[model samples]
Structures are given as C-alpha cells and as structure tokens.
Target chain A: MSVQPQTQARTRRTWLRVFLIIPFIVLLYPPFYNSNDPTFIGMPFLYWFPLLWILLTAILTGALYFLGA
Target chain B: MFTFNPVAFTVFIIFFLIVTGMGFIAARWRRGDLDQINEWGLAGRRFGTTVTWFLLGGDLYTAYTFIAVPAAMFGLGVLNGWFAVPYTILVYPIIFILMPKFWSVCKQRGYVTAADFVKDRFGSRTLAFAIALTGIIATLPYIALQMFGIQVSLAALGIPLSVSIGGLQIELPLLIAFLILAAYTYTSGLRAPAMIAMVKDIMIFIVLIALLIVLPAKLGGFGAIFAAVAKKHAASPTTFFEFLSPKQNWAFVSLALGSALALFLYPHSLTGVLSSNSKNVVKRNTALLPIYSLMLGLLALTGYMAIAAGIKPPKSLGANYAMPLLINAQFPPWFAGFAFAAISIGALVPAAVMSIAAANLFTRNIYKEYISPNASERAESTVAKWASFVLKFGAVLFIIYIPTAQVINFQLLGGIWILQTLPAVFLGLYTNWFNRWALLIGWFVAEVLGTILFSAAGLKSVYAISIFGVSFPAMYTAFSMIILNLILAIVLTPIFNVIGLGRGRDITVATDYDAEEVLPVEAGREALG
Candidate 1:
C-alpha cells in the first residue's frame, strides 16, 4: 500500500506514456479489418466503435489504479 | 412549417417559470462562503457522489444530445448519430485518469479553474490566458447550440416567432429563457444548477425511456423500423449503410479521437471533477456514466423510428425538430408538451453550468491573475457572476444572428477547435515533456487546418463520395484536422524540447501523482466535507 515518491513518479510516467499511444492506435486502424468481419457483437464495427472505446477506457483506468500510477 | 400550440406554449412557459422560481430559492440552500470563487463557481467544491453524478450528467447531456442526436440520425442517418455513443464512452475514462490528478493539484494549490492549474503549473500567465480564452470561445458556440436546441423544440411545439403585447411586437422567447438562466446561475453559483440538474436528469431519463418503449411499439415495432431504414439506405445507395471513404475515414477517426481528448479539457467538465468530494467518486462515475451511453444508443435509434413512422420534419425550420415532430405526431398534446419540456430543461442545465465554468475561468485566470493580481475572493466571485451573465447573453445573440443550420455547423467547427487543446490539457496531467510553446503551436496549427479543411469540404454536405464508381456522403474533414493536430503535437514536442522553447522547470514533482492513504487537511476536507 505504501510507495516511495520516486517509484510512484516513475510508474505514473510509464502509464501516461502508455495511454498517450492508445488514441493513435484506435484512430489509425481501418474501419474494417481483412481478417475480421465488419460486425462486432452483432452490430457493424462502426456501430460498435464507441462501445469499444467505452471498454478501452475502463480497462485503462483499471490498469492505472491497480498499477498505482 | 413549424407552429407552436398556444395551450402547450402557455403550459411550457408556466412550468419554466416555476422551475426558475425554485432555482432562485435554491440560492440559499447549502450556504457556503459566497465571496470565494470556489464557493460561487464550484459550490465550494463540496459536492458528494450523488450531487456530482447529477451535476455532471446534467452538464454533459445537454439539449444537444436530447434533441440533436436523434435529429442528426433523422437527417444524416447513422454517421452523425454515432457521435453520441462514442463521445459519452470516450470521455469517462479519459477523465478518470486526468481528473483525479487534476483534483489533487487543484486542491493542493486552491485552484478553482483549469486555467488556474495551467497558470500555476507552468508559471506562465500567457499560456493560462490562451487556455482561458479558448475555453470561453469554444463554449460560446456550444451554449448557442443549446439555445438552438430550445428554439427547435419551441418551433416544434408551434410557438409563434413573435408575440404581440398591446401593439408592441416582441421576439423574446430566447431572451426570456436566457435571462431566467442567468439569474439563478448568478444567485446560487454551481449549486443552483447542480440541484436543478437532479430534476432535469430524472425527467430526461423518464421521457427517453418512455419514448424508447412506446415509440417502437407505436411505429410497427423495431423490426419494421430497421427494415424501413435499411430499405431507405439501399434506395439512396449514397448516404446510409456505408463506411466513410478512406479519406473520410481518416477524418472520422481523427475527429473522434480529438474530441475525446479535448472533452475533459472544457472548464465545465473540470469543474465537475473539482467539485467531486473524492477521487473515488471520479473513478466510480467513470464506470457508472457509461449507462448514459446505453441510453444514448437507444435515443439515437429513435431517429430511424421517426423516419420509419413517416413523420416528415418541417421544411422551414431545420431537421433538429425531428424528435419533437415524431413525438408530437405519435403522442397526445399533454405528453408531447412534457417531452418538449424535457428537452428544454435538458438544454438549460448544461448551458448554465458551461457559462458558469467559462466565467470561472475568466475570473480566476483573466481577472484575478492579470487584472488585479491582488483581487479579493469577493471581487473574484462578483466578476464570475457578471461574466456568466454576459456569456448566457452572448449565446442568445449567437442564436439570433447566425442561421440555425449554420450555427449547427459552427458547433461542429467548434468541436474541431476545442479538440486542439488536448495536449495542453490531457497530456499535461501526468507529463512535463510538452513545452508550452509546442502546445500553443499545435493548437494553432490544428485550428487553422481544421477550419480550412472543414470549409473546403463544403460543410461536408450529404456524405457524397465515389468508391469504385459509387458515391456516398462526406464525413471526413473534421477527423482529418485531428490527425494533423496529433502529428504536429507529437513531432513538435521533441523539437521544442531540443530547442528549449517554452521549457520551464518541471513543476510537477514525482510525489504529486501518488494517491495518499493519509490525505492532507485541505484535500481531506475537499473530499469528505
């Protein structure tokens, strides 16, 4: 439960760097992937895109909290 | 084409007046040190989880979502409607990480606005001023969009454009509404709107859920509606059921990303964070708020249902009345009046909070930092009150002067401009690598390019594009600007750092990011009080 200030600082930096890369990945991907159908969970990939973001956000926040970043 | 029923209009006005009266009485509720900007602008930063939830919900889900999303779906089909779901989902997590840190820093330093944090953290008033100006300018169009929402609802209700009083013709609906909003926001500060938000949000939930259930059943069911929409898209072969072309796809993705980044950067969202009683509240809400997105998805579908029901929007007024028209046609007069009230009340709450948030930025960053530097808390609060009033008035003017359709387009344009502020905001939360000058340069580049591209695309009318000899509507321009912004920000960060442009000492020491078990006295009070 206790973290040194320096360790905590380094962890925070790592997490920030990780999160900053996500938008780029999500943004750069094409609408439809050749290997996958355009549907995700019975809706078109386009329709599910925002829902994807919702999940992405939750995972990222959980990571940051667990990692103590 | 759109006419307001006199009986419905009278009822609407009476209800609004009652709410306004209640809002005014709320001024004395949960009294705090009204002299302080935090007290006035942020409700003394004392809102617990329940209050914070309603405040943020009310603030974020404006008339824009309640009316505009369904309207966009009705007019433009799936593309624009998609924005609603993504925006709500994206904003929560983005704020989750950024907001807690911001809250800590602001609490540590007694910062009331995002501009305050920027000023103190960077020790540069110029950078702070730029951020403040951007928040206010960007928020103006957004507030105007809310007014547009109210106007559309009123038009749908058949309210006449002007009312004559003893041979004196007056065009005063928008003006009257704005004045009422300005009064209570000034009187009760954040709390006035925060309390009102509870009722507003509950009404929205009830209305939306009732419509979602009843509308589908009334319009030959969901299966029938989807079939109609699919048939319509197939017939057109140009607008619906088609992904953006490659060029447009880039724009779509970029706009979404840029907006996601810029969203929490808005002063009002930050005010919500600062007002929360604890970091846990922020975290919990990140998970909880997505429930609204679920509701939004249902709301978006109502547009397709409107189309399926064969309810044509009034030609003179713009398609924003699609929801109201559909509801009016399907329901009886009293229930339709209730729906109109839901949308109107929805617009009022966020507009009030946004004006208050922007005014707080002006007071804390512009007035106190630059104007007096030694201004008292009372002086800061007074300035914020007047600034909020002026902001609401300016929004009314924006609605009156600009064509409704053009104003809606400008709101999209404003999204592009606001998205440019991401690096200075979201990135600044946990890193010091980005120099202030680089952020400024990135923001300027994004704005200029976004404006040019959006305009060059001719406001992206009707999603027209040719893929292998087939065409579709254009929805790619705004997204393109976002890409250019990111590249510029990323590319310029190291360059500016290498050249030492706007590179100051790192004010965020490592210890600042840590979540403490034993909170400091002020932070503890801020979280628990």
Candidate 2:
C-alpha cells in the first residue's frame, strides 16, 4: 500500500464527510435564521432556510458518493 | 358529522382497489422462492437504487408525516410540528455515514436483524435477545399508530369509527383496512410494500403538489395564509411562534436529534435498507430520499393553510384531525377522495413493513434461536409469514383495546426504547471495544430510566429531567437518558475490563465492514445455486 497517497485521499474524504454534517449543525442553530426576514416566495427564512439546506446537503452527499468516498 | 358524498366515496374505492390490486400482484414482481426467510423477509435482499428509494421513502415517511405533521402545526406551531424538517434533514447525513456500513456488514454476515449482528459481534444471546425484544415491543405501537392514521383518514371519508353488531361495537373500518394490509403483506412480504410504495408515493406527491398550488390560491397566497397564522400567534405567543421560543430551543434540538438517530434504528427502516442490493444503492438513496423531506416541509405548511381557510377539526377528534378536516373543507369531493386515499395508502405501506420487520426479529432471534435452532430455511420463512400476521394483529389489538392518546404515548416511548440500543448496534458497528455485559447494562439502565422518567412525567409523552442535582432544560426523556447511557457505557468499559470481564472476540473483521461491492440478485442467486 502507498501510505502517503492513501492517507491524503482518506483525509480528503473525511473532509467531505465533515461537510455533510455542516448543514445538520447549521440548521440546528436556531439563532442564525430563526427570524421571519429574508422570505422566499412568501415563506419565512425560518422555514425556507432549512428547506434550502436539505437540498444543499443532498448535493454534497451525491458528490461524496460519486467521488467513491 | 358523516355526509354521504357519493363522488368522494366512489373515487376512494377506485384508488383503494387499484393499490390493493398492486399489492396482490407484487408477489410475482420478482418471483423468488418465498420459502427462505431472507427471500420473504427482506425482498431477497435484491432491491436496486430506485426501488430502495421509493421503498425507504415510503416506509420511513408514513401517514404520520401526512396527518400528524400538519395536525401538530395546526394545533401548536413550531416546537410541536416544524421540528420534523430539521429531523428529516439531519437524518440522511447521519445515515450516509452509518447505514452503508450496516448494509455492508449485514450482507456479509447474512444478518437479518440488528440482534443477529449483536449476537455474532458480541457473542451473547442475552444481548441479542434484549435488542430483539426491544425492537418488537417498540414497533407494535408504531404499527398501531399507522393503523390509527388509516382510521383517521377513514373517519374523514365519512366511515363510522365503530359499528355495533350483536352487542359487539367493533372499529369496523380500521379492522377492515388492517385485514387488507395483513393479507397482502403476509403473501407478498417486503415486495408488497416496495411495489405499492411506488403508487402511494406518486399519489402523495400529486396530492401534495395540487394542494400546495390550489390551497394557497383559495386561501389567498402563502403570505396571506402565514399572516393569518401570524395573527393567531400574535394573540397567543406562548403557544405558537414562527420561530422557536428561547425556552423551547433545547426541546426542539433534542427532539430533532433524538428522532434523527432513532429513525434508522427502527426495524422497518432497517428492513428497507437491508432489502437493497448494494452499498451504492443505500448511498445513492441518501441523496435521493430528501425529496420526501421537501414534501414534508410543504405538507407541514398545510396546517397553516387549514387555519387560513378557517377549517376546524371536531372537538371530539382533537387537533390530529386538522389536515383531514382541511382536506374535506378545501378540496372538491373527488379530489378529496384521492387525498384521503393517499393518506390511507400511506398507512398501509409502513404498516406492512413494520409488521414484517418486527416479525423478522421475532422469527430470527426468538423462534429460530430458542424454539428450533435446527429449523430449515423454509420453516423459518413460514414462521416469519405467520408471525407477521400475528404481530400485525397485535398492532390491531393495540388500536382497538388501547386509547389513541396512550398509543401515541407508546409510540413516543418506542423512540426512546430504540435509541437505547444505539451503543450496541450503531457504535458496535465501528468497534466491539465496549464489553457486551456493560453494553447490556447500559441498555437496561437507559430503558428503565427512560420509562421511569417518562411515566413520572405523567401523560406528557416526552420530557426532559434533572440528573444528580443539575436540571437540564425541558427536552425529550430519550435524549437525556441516552446521555446517561453513553456515560455509563464509557465509564463501565474500563471498570469491567479491570474486573476481568471479557468483551468477547470480535467475530466481524475490518474487511467485513469494508465490503463496498454491489452484488446484484442474479449473481446472489447463482451463488445460492
């Protein structure tokens, strides 16, 4: 096994996995987008913000899976 | 309260018949020998990505989402309701990391249940037995909840909740619906739900999108609908809010996190995952399944739409009827039939999967292990088929004999109870470093403490509590007990080691966990041949 290159690829995938958890953590922090400002097509940011992140996280996961991580 | 709307009833009967036909025919969808437990119980472990997506999305997001999410919001706003958005969003990422490994190892070991994995990994039948009993016990109420969902929809469709015959007042509609679900599930096994889910999900998405478009227009715009919600919340700020109140932040976070963790631990969810053919299918689903979460978000808003349309649930049914009542109020009679059928079909899919999953646990861990260790695969499959019916009837008995309030409470306890197995099942996926005895002790402590805390809190289904002179904010009893459970598992590991209690040999190697190759069903069958 090529130790150095394998470690580099493993770390890259680990970072990608960490990216997956970001949206989960972000949506849980209520203070960030808990207000009714920044509405999207009449939905309060409170609702639309997390809804948007659901897709964003999905995109990130799709990327990670295809990347063979 | 019951008006005979001929159009709605006819349309409902039409869609209901269509799905029922789909269920019976699904037995031949992928003609496998149903004699083997693996073939019958887990769809022969042969589902590809798209099928797995529909099956899991249909299985995990139940009538609970269709009725309860909107109803909760209509009744109590953000804390009670909208937490599901975060819960669903958080669920995938967690599963993305955890479930593929679970699929991989379970496939390699031919493990049908988490208890199977626990018994093999930890070398303890007692621990495996603990996990199986908990899965079945937690699942009975969950299956009953889905029955209750169908009952609510039936009640909305103008069927009486009960009919008296020969001094016997029976819940005729629910019993009839449960029988249909039981018959198909017993015959078709997991394939029944996987096939019917394709139709149920389509109807649900259609009903959801049609309502999202039509209800907003009828009730003015989303802005107007929310403004009415705002007005109501403005009047009673304590009960309803667009955002979480400061006091509710912990409750919201813990409820969302605890539920996200517990979602996959449910045997029904595992049945959906293990039915898939590959790690890649499970991984692909992590990306695709959020379509339901988006639908859940849109559907939850219908509660506010119900309010804006000035629809009121009957005082008898309470707030859980909010969405069903809103459906009847807002939609034309024919379309209302389709919507009601969507909700009721939604109930059948998960109810079938739940009973099969529980029955899989019962047959594999209980009967095959204890009753007849030398039982043939065909006999095991037979037991699973019969047990699925009996387990489902147990759920039916729950609905008939138990109050709906208590059933919902039991469902909440189900969430708490399943999370107790996290250390043994989820954590053990990575390492068997923790002693099995200590892990069982952790599970026992959490189960007893969680139940005691829950009961001590009275009829309130979920709550937070103080531990050792420190008061945590009001949150789910499950989340709090899980913290204590984790602490005990961690602390007791070293002590148990010092006392020379063996953790048993790790039967699973790293390569078992690292099996990422997808084996399609033909190759799997040839291997069997």
Chain A TM-score by candidate, in order: 0.51, 0.75
Cα RMSD over interface residues, candidate 1: 4.4
Best by TM-score: 2
What total of clashing residue pairs does each candidate reach?
A: 16, 0
Query: Which is the leading candidate under lDDT?
Result: 2
lDDT of 1 by residue, B1-529 (tens): 6555666667677667767876887677678887788788888777766778788888877777877788878776655666556556666656765777887777776778777766656556777788888889989989999998888777778776558889986657767777888889988888877878887788788888889788877777766776677677778767664344445554354445556666787777888888876676776677667666677777887888888888776577556777788888887777777778878888888898899899998888888877888988788899999999999889888988888888777777777766666666666776766667766777787778667766776764222335598654454444555556668877887898787676655565555654543534344344333
Candidate 2 pairs with clashing backbones = none
Report per-candidate DockQ. 0.26, 0.77
Tell me the whole-model lDDT of each prediction, alpha carbons only.
Answer: 0.72, 0.88
Residues A13-61 of candidate 2 have per-residue lDDT tens digits of: 7777777768867977887888899888788888888889879878888
- TM-score of only chain B in every candidate structure: 0.90, 0.96
